[model samples]
Target: MKKLVKLMVFIIALYIFLEINNQWLVVTEHVLESEKIPSSFNNYRITQVTDLHDATFGDNQQKLIEKVRATNPDAIFITGDLIDSNRYDLENSLHAVEAFVKIADVYYVLGNHEVAINKMDEIYIALIELGVHVLPNESLVLERDGERLAIVGIEDPLMGMETEEMLNIALANVPDDMFTLLLSHRPERFDTYVAKDVDLVFSGHAHGGQVRLPFIGGLVAPGQGMFPKYTAGTFTENDTTMVVSRGLGNSIVPYRLFNLPEIVVMELKSK
Candidate 1:
């Protein structure tokens, strides 16, 4: 009887640990430096919130908002998967964005989930109403101290258009030499972003491979399949650098193991 009792206690403890890992939020920071970064924009902070899947962190998303506010980001980038297609909860997801807009300029792009929901119009309208810059195959310029930095966003390829074609149209007007930042949903397209000479890219979708392994890295990802690359962290090739967020919420998997929810806080520096 004592042995059985001890076994039950161990099982309960393990369950609690896993639950905390999934529910708790953690912040990860990275500093990126490049000569292309305009001097005026040095020390520019960008807080990335991705793949939320409509998960809540505290009442009205206060906990999540506070985390971003503490970072003092000049801009908040909502890479994609803000709402899970499975759950399709726009109002719940927007709770975070509403607060984010008041903190800093909010930029967003579509994810596979948004495409699957087929309610893109409704989602776009709602975010735009809340002062969020919904960039769907669009480009805009951020000018400070007489210097220019282009921000380009593309829709997920799941939206019927090829990713490459969408990128071409988006960059048609932007100069080749200008410092450009691309907000994309799929990280598997790193090669395409590099080929286009994009200076930086922010992406999310893997959900940190859903389950991370000890040294083998992420167990699986959406595009890359088993042990997929670009699950999280920064990747650089040529002049292009992509930061992949593990993301904050889950989708079909329904649970996370070892992989805690993460918010990537990136600070840009001019070399």
Candidate 2:
């Protein structure tokens, strides 16, 4: 019995040690094939970074910026949670977004934190000044080679508004023939996007369950309870595909186990 107890303690200690250390920020590349993808836009690269929560990577997010620059994406998408309301760092978050603005066409949507903290107005104004396109429950047309695509961004559902109606109105402008992309904060609400017939969705709020195990996936997420189904990776339903990022920063629990920070690079193909 004593030996078993000692082994358990050792395992626990090792787990904690691993959680605090070795948080390597790795890039996960995904290739998505779609018939709707424009011929001129084939092989278009999109870099997604989410759940920053005011965490700094190197001096003033230099390391993160360098990695993004290396990717040379056609556009950068920030799903949500640029700053944590509970532990706010305005400068770091704004600076990071500012740096990103210079790199690519930055498009963003709010996560729960942005609403909870009541900084959406201020941050939205700031982002606009930096040339970052902040899409709020609307679709924006992206054109290349005379072919057009639609990207829709929605406000997080934490604001106690009618989601189904709001989404219907937001997506009303997108034509049936055009390829569509959605920037939603919550991955758990993927069903909503699928129901709306959106082609692709990008989200980050689960934080990769805050801690993950190999094969087991994520442990727990905010909206989804223990062993949440939509914690990480890609989920496809019908014609819609949802890409959930493990996220680039931490919140609430303040640590990640086996789940390292990541920047998701999605390569869109005209298959």
Candidate 3:
């Protein structure tokens, strides 16, 4: 009995150590069947980082950034939760922004936390200053090697900022031959994007339930109840593909088991 107890203690200690030190980078490549995707864009890479929740400059974040940079993505998308609260250290947000800016073309959308903290404008301005494009009910045409793609960003729906009319207006000028990508903070309203014929949607808000359970998936997600459908990874509705990142950080709950911090790299392919 004594030996068994000692072994169990040793194993527990090791598990904790690994959790602190085990920085993992999960890569997911997605293929969207879009008529607008040019043949030349057979494999355009897009890296996604979401729900950071102020986990910056730490070993996990550093490792995640390094891994993302290594992927050599054509563009990077941050789906929100960049800051935990306006009360927490703003420096962490700066750090997180700087890290991504150094790698690829960074784009972002606001999350509920930003609105909850009532610092959305401040955070938006700061991120824009760092050369990160803040896409809130806005659209930008991405031109690379003579190929044009439309990228749209919508504000947080839960915050009551998302407008279907605004989204349509943003895409009004986009030609039918151009591929469209939408960045939203929540995955709950995927149907709206699908109706608009959006080729891909990237989001992260559930934090993969913050603490995923074994075999059964996530236990609970904020705003979303137990076993949230869009907790982490990919979900498809019609022709639209939605990639919900597990995110790099945590909030309300600080520990992750089974679910590790994720940095998604989606490679867009032409059909």
Model 3 root-mean-square deviation? 2.9
Model 3 lDDT on a 0 to 1 scale: 0.79
lDDT of 1 at 149: 93
When sorted by TM-score, best at the front, the candidate numbers are 1, 2, 3
Q: Give candidate 1 regions above 4 Å deviation.
A: 1-4
TM-score, cand. 2: 0.92
Candidate 1 global TM-score: 0.97
Best by TM-score: 1
Which segments of candidate 3 are over 4 A away from where they belong? Answer: 1-23, 57-61, 162-166
Write one digit per residue (lDDT tens) for candidate 3, span 1-271.
Answer: 9999999999999788657632454666665666668766778889888877777545545666677788888889988888887345556667756888988889999888887887887888888889999987888998767877889988876566455765776678777657888888888777787888788889888888766777778888877788888887788877788988888777777677778778888887777
User: Of the pair 2 and 3, which is ahead by lDDT?
Assistant: 2
Candidate 1 weakest lDDT stretch, 10 residues: 17-26
lDDT winner between 1 and 2, please give it.
Answer: 1
Sliding window of 10 residues with minimal summed lDDT for model 3: 17-26
Q: TM per model?
A: 0.97, 0.92, 0.87
Best by the lDDT measure: 1
The local distance difference test score of each candidate is 0.92, 0.88, 0.79
